[model samples]
Each structure stands twice: as C-alpha cells, then as structure tokens.
Target: MMMNMFFYMGLVSLIVLTLNSKHLLLMLMSLEFLVVYIYFGLFIMMIYMNYEYYFGMIFLTMSVCEGTLGLSILVSLIRSYGNDYFQSFNILW
Candidate 1:
C-alpha cells in the first residue's frame, strides 16, 4: 500500500514535469520529487531483496549532487536574466 502511494506520487511528478515545464524552479522541484520517489523505491526493493544499502547510498549522493547542480544553474539564470521562465531562456544566449 505504501509503495503504491509513492508510485502514484512519482507518476504525478512525472506528469507535472512533462506538462508544466515553463519555469526552471518548478522543473527542478519536480525532478527532486522524482528523485525522492526513486530513492524510496530503491529502499523498499533493497529491504525486500535483503540487499546491501550501498547502492541506495550512492544513488542518494548522486541525487543530491544533481539537485545542487540544478539549483546552482537556476541561481545563475536568475542572476543573469532576473527570471526563471523557460520562455526567456534562449539557447543562443
């Protein structure tokens, strides 16, 4: 039952990430949500399979790094352009 709930939450985050990607902050938040869901799923799987938690730790570390990178990028973008909207995020700039 708990697993199913987390699965649905992950699905919702994925849908939000797909449908509403206009703001960098929102996208990053959804990405973080997905990462959290993945970590939870991994934890549950490890418990059920009686596997070592080393992989989960690695995954969590990587996720945290990714989140920090995303936030840094967002901060830089905001500083440069004063907005987080993807509409103004020109690739050629």
Candidate 2:
C-alpha cells in the first residue's frame, strides 16, 4: 500500500541521516523527508479509518512545530560554524 511505502521511505531516510554524518544539508533533507512521509501516512490512516478532524489537526500542528524547531536548530548550527557539516560539532572542555 502507499502508506507502507511512505513508512518505509521515512524509515530509510532516518537511517540514512543517522549513518551519514558528512553533510548537514543532506541530514536536514532526510529529516524533512521523514517528517513529510510520517505526515502523509498519518493523513492516509486517518482518512481510511474515519478518524476525527482533531487528530489530523494535531498532526499538522506537530509537523509545523517540528519543521520550525528543525530549521531553527539548523540555522543556529550554521551560524556557529560556517559550514553545515556534522563533524564540525566539537566540544572540548
């Protein structure tokens, strides 16, 4: 089914983000893909199961919050370091 495909794509994107630490942009892209897929899957399930509108609204809210937080974090990270590379995060005391 389409839902299953989206779920698998989200899972794969998460895995790719976890394994590849070189490109922060790629990681962000993967994160966005995962979130979108999750949203799509949830939307499909709600429609198929005849859920209430509140559930869909909640999911949309969550997706918005997630996107905002992720973009903020990415912006901060980029500002701190001139590049969007995961390896640039080095904390030393």
Candidate 3:
C-alpha cells in the first residue's frame, strides 16, 4: 500500500528530474522530492525493523546540508548569470 505509493512517487520525481534537466530550479525541486521519498522510506523501514532512529536523524541532517549546499551554489550562479537556465551558463571558462 504505502510502499507502492512511495515507489510511484519516487518514479514520478525521477521522471520530472530527467525531463526538466534544462531548468536548475525544476531539477533541484525534483531532487528534493526524491530525497524526501527516501527519508520516508527509511522511516518506514525503521518502524518495521524496530531499529533506533539515530541513523535516520543523521541521514536527515545530511540531506538538509546537501539541500542547503545546492541552494547556495544556485544562488551564486544566479547572482552572476541572472537566471537558472543551464543554457545560460558555460563550463569552458
């Protein structure tokens, strides 16, 4: 039941992430959704295994740090480039 729902949601987010690769914001959003789905899946596994939640907390902390890092990078890029479009930036510099 819930497992199927999570699987479908993860799949959808992956599709969105793939289809919207040109827009940084959209890619970030879908990646965030995928992270959230994994977090929930971890929560469900912990509940079933009767395990401590310390690992989950650590994972959540890491995920938050990852998101903040990504946002900061995005902000720096937008500040210099004026937009979040990948086509607007160059890698050869």
Off by over 4 Å in 2: 1-4
**Candidate 3's residue-wise lDDT over 1-93, tens digit each?**
877888899999999998998988888889999999999989989999999999999999999999999899899989998989977889524
Give a tens-digit lDDT track for model 1, residues 1-93.
Answer: 876788799999999999888998999999999999888888989999999999999998999999999999999999999999988988636
At residue 4, candidate 3 shows an lDDT of 87
| Model 3 TM-score (2 dp) | 0.93
Best-first order by TM-score: 3, 1, 2
Off by over 4 Å in 1: none
* Candidate 3 C-alpha RMSD relative to the actual structure: 1.5
TM-score of each: 0.92, 0.75, 0.93
Clashing pairs in 3: none
Better of 1 and 3 by lDDT: 1
Residue 13 in model 2: lDDT? 86
Clashing pairs in 2: none
Q: Candidate 2 lDDT, tens digit per residue, 1-93?
A: 865776688779889989876987787778878777777777777888998778778877887888788788879888988878777778511
